[model samples]
Target: MTRLYNDPQAFADEMIDGFVAANSRWVRRVSGGVVRATRTEPGTVAVVVGGGSGHYPAFGGLVGRGLAHGAAMGNLFASPSAQQVHTVAATAHRGAGVLFSYGNYAGDVLHFDQAQERLRAEGIECRTVRVTDDISSAPADRADQRRGIAGDLTVFKVAGAAADAGYDLDGVVRVAERANERTRSFGVAFSGCTLPGADAPLFTVPEGRMGVGMGIHGEPGIHEADVPSADGLAELLVSSLLGEVPQSVDTVRGARVGVILNGLGSVKYEELFVVYRRVAQLLAEAELEVVDPEVGELVTSFDMAGVSLTLFWLDDELERLWGAPCDTPAYRKGALEPAELIDDTELAAETAAEIPPATAASRQVADVAVAALATMSRTIDEHVDELGRMDAIAGDGDHGIGMQRGVHAAVDAARAAHAAQAGAGTVLALAGDAWADRAGGTSGALWGAILRAVATEVGDERVPDAAALARGMRAATDAVLRFGAVVGDKTMVDALVPFADELETAVGDGAGITAAWARAADAAAAAAAASADLMPRMGRARPHAEKSLGTPDPGAHSFALLMRAVLTTTTNGRNAS
Candidate 1:
């Protein structure tokens, strides 16, 4: 359990500040995260890696020479916002380009891809190589769908080394892909992790039992079994990985590999050493040569009592890169020449965008929008724990906190835009940006898309009507569908699509906006409730589908709740404007 925290919502930001202050020599403060304080070679490709905040050394800790040039740190258990990623990449880019790498998760994919598009639009070359090295997340035939784990170290190390060795964008991507293809990892959990201020752990394992193939994010494991002795546990981990060796490696005999016995958190070094002790014997027995093996925490999941084993199969080039001298806040290796520190220390954050002019009617609608946003903030605050409890059934248990962060930011932005005399559309759009930027996860991105899509339909000059809102809802549904989740995927799409369809149908039937919206909210609520029976086919919960069978998806439930909450606020005949 996490004991020390001032504001749970402020934990990630506070932690980053303290970390930067302590590691100023290796990393300097940037808007999104830390960039290497040490100067890099001109024209070197900047390797920017990131994900959620709970994983130490994985993201921020790896920023230094011969590793990630910068890392975009997000809230705990949330992916960094697209704005954050773009900011870090822009700052880190030397002259060659930027290579983005991180664990293969849905939120990370969405935000990082968005950032990549933005960078390319500005003529800064950007490429991404998602780390899909966790063997337990997916089947061998569908390896690309695997989520990354401790194997992230191998990919990042090789990418950083290749970038520093003067590889261009293409060359860096190629080597990074090579490293990803050659790595495999498996993990087990003896206990669940507790988020700060949470009443209980995300998911608890039975006493004397261990969860096999557990995710680093407190996702329940594929199976559970009686905990075994250290040697027995090592045998299980080693044999499991050995059975699923990468296709590139024809055989395990005589293959040189880089091994990492990573503690997920709360697993002390001595325990990890005991497990690695037997892991080493097993690898040697299988005739594999180990090089530069790491036996400590690299990637962690807060206080999860879990450990993962990663085997990075190394060819000649990869071996040299793995052995390259490097320095970072964490995970320093062989000595290196003194690095020059960067001179410019100023960090000017971009402020709220200027508000566009609005018509009187539109400004009236903007006032209503601001009020609706406030209602949403209050609604989320009231039901945050309920939403989080639902998500914790099969997720990392951060849904409540993520929503709290997003809705609060949305409310703040909407209030600011209203004060600036912005239109309803402009206010919602700005609020949406803040929601996504502050929340930094799947829910955040979806809400942002939904708001922006709705904003486009009701421009600055027009007062939003029933038809416009129905159309906006349809467009929002389309935006979500583009992310590849369907109605039965046990995601927000399950509730949102039904609500949009119901709204359009009701409005087309000449029903008033109030009636149509209420009807749509009812439909959404039903869909969200029925989601309790559907297996999760998307996002982090997919790995623990069985565990979610009787629970509604947190995303779907939250969307439904938010819809209902907004409906109540717009009760002046539901056009509100």
Candidate 2:
């Protein structure tokens, strides 16, 4: 368990600050994360990598002369926001373009793709290569769905080396993609990790047993078994990977591969060497030549008692790139020449936001929106522990925190907009931006989309009626569907769709805004409770859906709670009138 923390919510920020302080020679502070302190060659393709915090050397630690130009750090176990990614990319881009690379998780994919779109819109060439290298997460037929693990190092290393070697945007992307294709990893855990200030671990393994194919983000393993001896464990890891080599490789025999025996937090270095001893013998026995086998922690969960092995199949080109000289705060290979540092004056200046003009009537409605967000903030705070407990059943236990961060930021932004005399639509839109920017995960993105959709319908020109609100709810449902979910997928959509339908029906039946919202809230609550029986078909929780049986989805439950809270706020307004 994590023993030290000033405040649980502030852990990630504190860690980044300390890291930058200690590694001043390698990295400098940026808005979202750290960029390389050292300057790069002009026109070189900048490699920007990122993900949730707690995966140390993986993201921020890798920012230096020969690795990632910058890293967008997010809250623990959550993907960085799109705004974070774009800020890092903008700061890192030299003259040519930028290449964004990270693990293939849902939040990471959503945020990185959004950042890529933003960069391109501004005429800055940006591309992305998602690393999918965990063989245990999916079948070889659908390898693209695999989650990245220790193999991330191989892909990032090669991509960074390629970028350092002056590859253009296309060339860097190709190398990164090829590296991801060649790399494969599998992990096991003796115990689960604990988040800071959390009273219990995310999951637990029975004594004398181990979890197989677990994820780095405290996700429970797919299977469990009695703990094996060092040799036995090494054989298990090796055989599983050898059974399904990359499509490009005909056979493991006579192939040269880069090996990584990664320790996931609690595993000591001596234990890894003991396991690697057997792993090395097994590789030789299989007639594969091992090149530059790394045996240490490269990526890690907070304190997970686990380890993973990665194999990067090496061709001539790959071999050269793999052996390229590099230097970073965490990992180093060969040697690197000294580089110039970024000038103090070259840092980006903060820009002020330009609020659109709003009419007086619109400003009045904006006050109501601000009040609604305040209600949401209070409601989320009240149910945070309950929501987090539900999410901990199968998913990462951060939904409650994410929602709190998002709604609080939304409330703050809404207040500012209302004070600025902005329209209701502009207030909600600004609040949505803050929610997404501060929340930095799947829930955050979805809520942001929902708010933006509602804002479009509740324009500044008119007073939002029950019909307009229903239409906005319908649009919110559509946006959620377009973001890739259906009613039975066991997501928030299950509750959202019902609420939207019931709201439209209630409004059609001549209900007032408060009445319609109260009815919709009831529908959403029923739908959310019903979701307890559903097996998840989407998101990180899908693989372990069975474990979540009889527990409501955290997202669905939170949506229901938010609906009811907002209903109360509206009803109160009506009573006051």
Candidate 3:
């Protein structure tokens, strides 16, 4: 359990500040994450890697001379926002291009892809390689769906080495893909982790029991069994991984591989060595040659009692790349010559702000938006515990915390916009950016898109009426669907679609905005409850879809809750007027 934190909401940001202060030689603080303090060749390809913050050495620690040029660290167990990714990439990109790499999670994919599109639009060459190496998450035929675990180190190392060796963007991408294809990993957990200020673990294992195929984000395992001895556990991981060597390698026998015996937070190094002893013996008995072996924490969940093993199959070229020198804050290999550092003044420039023009009438409506946002924040705060409990059933238990952070930020932004005499559309747009930028997850991205769609439909040209409100709701639904989910996918879109349809119908039948919203809110509540019967087809919950069968999706439930809360606020305001 995390015993120390000043404020739960400010944990990630504060942690980054302390890390930059401690590792001044290796990295400097950037807005989203950190970039290498040392300078690189001007036209070299830049390799940027990152994910959620709890995975320490993985992201920020790996930023230095022969590893990632920068990392866009996100909130705990969440992916960085697209805006965050774009900002870090822009700061890191020197001249040639940029290569973005990270775990194959839903939020990371969405944000990184969006950032890649944005960079290309501005004439900066950008590419991505998502590490899919956890064999237990998906079947052999669906390798693309496997989650990236500790094997992330292998892919990131190779990609960074390729970039450091002066490979172009295409060449670096090719090597990164090959590394991901060859790497395989499996893990187990004895117990789950607790976030700061949380009273309980995200999920728990029974006494003397262990979870097999557990994820790093405190997600429960696919199966549970009695705990095995160190040797027995070693055999479990080794045999399972050897059974699925990549098709490129004919067999594990006589093949050379790089191995990482990674500790997932609470597990001590001495216990890891005990397990590794058996692991090394077994690999030798199987006639496999192990190259440079690493045994320690590389990627980690906050205080998780678990460990993972990764095998990276290597050919001659891959061997050379794997052996390349790197000097990061946490992980270091062979020595390298000293490099020049980036100037402080040039790196301190922040992202440029945008203020769209607005009309006088729309500014009055902005005040109303501010009130709605404040009410939404209070509602989310009230239900945070319930939302976290629901998410822990089949996903990472951070939904409640993420939503609270996002809504609080949105409320603050809306209040500031109202004070500035901004229009309704501008206020909504600014609030959307704040929510996505601070929340940094799948929910954050989807909600940000919904807000932006509504903002576009409610421009400052005129006063927004029921017809305009219906149109904005419709646009929000469409934007969510096109972003990555549909009604049956068991996401917020399930509730949102029903709410939008009912609202449009009510307004068409001559109902006022408040009445239409109330009716739509009821529809959303029903849709959210009905989602319990569904099996998730997308996002992190997909791998454990069966486990989520009897529970409502946290995303859908929160959306419905927000709808009902907004309806009450709007209806009360109308009655008073």
Candidate 4:
């Protein structure tokens, strides 16, 4: 049913055409499908890299200012031919010479070796660096036999920096080899990817099972295990990496380390953070000093569900290189800073003391709010079909499902807090935990943070009047805006901005809490309705801004409903009193 090209040769050519077209500033195709980018410092030692084509940014995207000078691109899952590698090396070679680097795959080795010989015969000096970091691909004693994973980034950066520093060809090759020696990576796949127009996936795994040691190109993993929670997954990955590194308190006492939490594809950033939280704790337990941690979709397989961890043991020189100023379309290394020394005991104590206690009245409010939210949760779930359909027109379809999960978790936590007779702050804390656990998206996390901010503002208040409510709303709005840059950009702000404004107006008019809430709810609903004609300017939908026109944002609609429920409840309570 797919209209995309099924032929690997055709697909590869088309992809390379599009890639070169979009990235002319950084890359261009040379003879034999070799994409080469001009070096930032011409006449410096050149780094030529390559791998299969499907891994977009890898090998290809790395060819830029502070990374590889040339990339030999191949067909999806297939290595570039010897001519491709030779052409890339020839194009990238400076008078200083060229260093060839690539993952440790049979075909890559064979092709790159052939290219190396060809380049040498042409009177161009050349050497090679192979990355073998995937522990799953080889035995502990044979780690050098494993295929490369995400650690390719480290090799490229280190080698590129060495070359930029005026290292000769052999010296640059040594730096790259050292990077490959010190760096390690491992990955697990939750799902497989489809190859272009293939009717079936390139490979298949059982449902709810994760393929450990899965190759990025759909090769069989070591084994499939039952899917684990994000925390569990992080633990698994951290344990494996730690085993390889074998850190002792003494070994890590004064050492700085770089931790990279990379998503394969389709794994949400929120989920990645959850994994990072656990990984951070694990590293701390091992007493390894974390220098700069990066978490995101750095290397991806097309639509595959998986994540990989890359650990680079940092030395003073490597640290300097890692922190060196470099810029590319996908990666940028900001200015470097000295690692801060943190006392573990002090950190633990501070965290414990910062958690505020919850009160009885706060628990009551939380209980009622939870029940109301739970009832609304079903509404969110039911509307998911519609929401996903709407989102598919302009953005990803997870918005509705993400919200439903988040609201349900928040309600559930509120119920638990109420049963435990938690104080106001504690109830809010519980709500935050629930939000983080269930929301699994940027908006959900933003909403959760907003709730926690409001709870912190309200504190132990037994009865929040119009002024207090207004202050709380203002705090919540500020928190959301701080967490995400979507406010005033046609996101939930379409409804929330009006709700806060109406609340302020009501309070200024000397309206009671109930009346003010009612006014705010009406304004929020009206604003949400009005947003149907506005264009989205934030989030993933922003890129397709025109497509979202004439449709109300799901976030705005949800905000309006929440305000309506709160207003209705407040009015009923006032009338009963």
Best by lDDT: 1
lDDT at 439, model 3: 88
| Predictions: Cα RMSD each | 1.5, 1.9, 1.3, 23.1
Evaluate model 1: give its lDDT.
Answer: 0.90
Regions more than 4 Å wrong, model 1 = 345-349, 572-575
Candidate 2 lDDT, 110-217, residue by residue in tens: 888888999999999988888999887878888888888999899889999999998899999998999999999999999888888777777788999998999998
Worst 10 residues of 4 by lDDT: 344-353
Off by over 4 Å in 4: 1-8, 33-42, 246-250, 335-577
lDDT of each: 0.90, 0.88, 0.89, 0.70
Instruction: Please give the lDDT score for candidate 4.
Output: 0.70
Model 1, span 1-577: residue lDDT tens: 9999998878989999999999999988877788999988879999999999998977999999888999999989999999999999998888899999999999999999989999999999999999998888889998998999999999999999889888899999999999999999999999988888788887789999998999988777778999999999999999999998888887779999999999999999999999999999999999999999999999999999988999999999999999998899898889889988987544445665988888988898888888888888999999988887888788877788899999999999989888888998999999999899889989888999999999889878888778999999999999978878998889999999999999999999998778899999999999999999999888999977888998888998899999998899878443563
Tell me which residue pairs clash in candidate 3: none
Compared with the true structure, the alpha-carbon lDDT of candidate 3 equals 0.89
Measured against the true structure, the TM-scores of the candidates, in listed sequence, are: 0.97, 0.96, 0.98, 0.56
Best by TM-score: 3
Give candidate 2 misplaced runs (Cα > 4 Å).
Answer: 460-462, 574-577
Residue 95 CA displacement from its true place in model 1, Å: 2.2
lDDT of 3 by residue, 435-462 (tens): 9888888988888888888889887656
lDDT for 102 (candidate 3): 94
Clashes of 1: 0
TM-score of 3: 0.98
